[model samples]
Structures are given as C-alpha cells and as structure tokens.
Target: MVNDIIADERSPVSASGHAYGEAERREANLIYEYADHLQRHGHRVARQLIQIPGEPRPHRTDLYDTSTNRLIEAKGTLHREAVRLAIGQLFDYRRFLSPEPALGLLLPAKPSADILELCRALGVKIIWQEGGGFTESSGG
Candidate 1:
C-alpha cells in the first residue's frame, strides 16, 4: 500500500564528492516513503525537518509523528561506522533541536545488539526496518 506524493524537489549535488546539500532531501524522501506507507494503512503522519537556530541550518530528523506529536529521527546504515556516525549526529541534533521525548528509527543492514544498547543509553526509542516495513523494538 504505497501512497507516495512527491511534493519536494531534489537539490543539486555538491562538488566535494559529498552530497552535503542533498542530505535533507534524501531524509525527506525516506520519511515520505515511510509516512506514505503508514498513511495507506489509515494512520495519519506528519514529517518535519527540525532546524535549530544558530546551529547548522539543517539538522537530522527525517520525519515526525504529528498524531502522537513525537519527533522521529531516521538513520540508514550498512556498517558499524555508519551507525556510529548516525548515533553521534542524533545526539547532537537532539540536544540542539530539543524535541521533547525524541525517538530514533535505525534502518540498518542488520539489527545489532550494540546499536540498541547505545540508543537506550541515550533515552531514544528504536524502530527497525526489515523486509518491506518497520517494527518497533525495545532498546533494552
């Protein structure tokens, strides 16, 4: 059940070999894809990008749940380093964005115990995406 409505435009890639400007766009796409999937199942979803003042113009956090009014941060990882990077970024963003009661969605190649423990230590919830959809799991 896919209900994707492409509302945003993509940003041009930068010349540094790093798609810096496209991070938010990529995150938005992931959020929209997930939200659309949920919406097809009759759940209302709202996605937002939290931009903290005086900090980097754009911060992490692909989507947010408007119904529950929860802040959701999405992380896509294929390796340990990627997970570490995402976790570190999430901590920083959580501090800066200051979203009351923040939850993190870790989209990893495989679910690792170490990752879950880290999220728990940071007081963040976990959501794992496997197969074609996602499942919430206890961090402990």
Candidate 2:
C-alpha cells in the first residue's frame, strides 16, 4: 500500500485548476483519523491503488481494512450528495479488487435518517466518529 499516503499529512493535490479547499482537507483528515482508529483496534488499514480496465490511471482508495476484509471510503460531510458520491466510489472500487472486500463509508458524523436508510439499502456500512472511537452500522 502506498505507505499511508493520506496519513502522511502532505499537501493536498488538486487535479482541477482550483486549489484544494477545506472540504477536501476535511475529507483527508477524516480518512486519516479513522484509519488511525482502526489501527488502534489492531486492524491493518492501508491505501490501495486499482487499475481499471480501459483506464490509463489508477484509483486510490481511502483505506482498506485488511483485518476485517473491508474497503472504506470517507466523506467529510453527511450531506446526501457527499454520501451518494462515496457510495459510488465504493461500488466502483469494489469491482477491481481481487478479494471483493465488504464496502464501508466513513463519515465525520452520523448521517441523516434517510441517508442512513439509503446506505442500508445499498449494503454500505456507515461508520462515523462517536466519542473517542467510531460507530458502524449493522451488517454490510
């Protein structure tokens, strides 16, 4: 895994002309923090690179929990759009991985009721910061 690229706290890289904003920074921090939380629980979380068919570049996952066999995508906010985007990313990332890990979404806070239902319907585990640790939705 890329030596925990996001965990290194390096300057953000923006693909578009605009620079990285607070939202991007927040998402990166959330991913890093959640990965640390997973580590303390004796789980091995690592960044992953996937080369999709007909794609010239690789896509990087926020973190993959090797111990639990789950792939996680983190979003900075609980907004519907953000969660929707994360869901899309997890699905896209899943098809290319060899072991087909269970999908997870890490958020800064618990999502709204509808959002929670949406994730549940899609079989996406919702994990959010709670107290000093993280809380995960039941099932996959």
CA lDDT of each prediction against the hidden true structure: 0.58, 0.83
Model 1 clashing-pair count? 0
lDDT of 2 by residue, 1-140 (tens): 33354854345666675778877778888887887777777888887888888999788888889998899998887778888899999999999887889999999888788888888888999999888888998856
Error of 1 at 67 (Å): 1.8
Look at candidate 1 and tell me the lDDT of residue 22.
44
Of the candidates shown, which would achieve the greatest TM-score relative to the real structure?
2
Q: How accurate is candidate 1 locally (lDDT)?
A: 0.58
- Write down the lDDT that model 2 would get: 0.83
Q: Rate residue 62 of model 2 by lDDT.
A: 87
Clashes of each: 0, 0
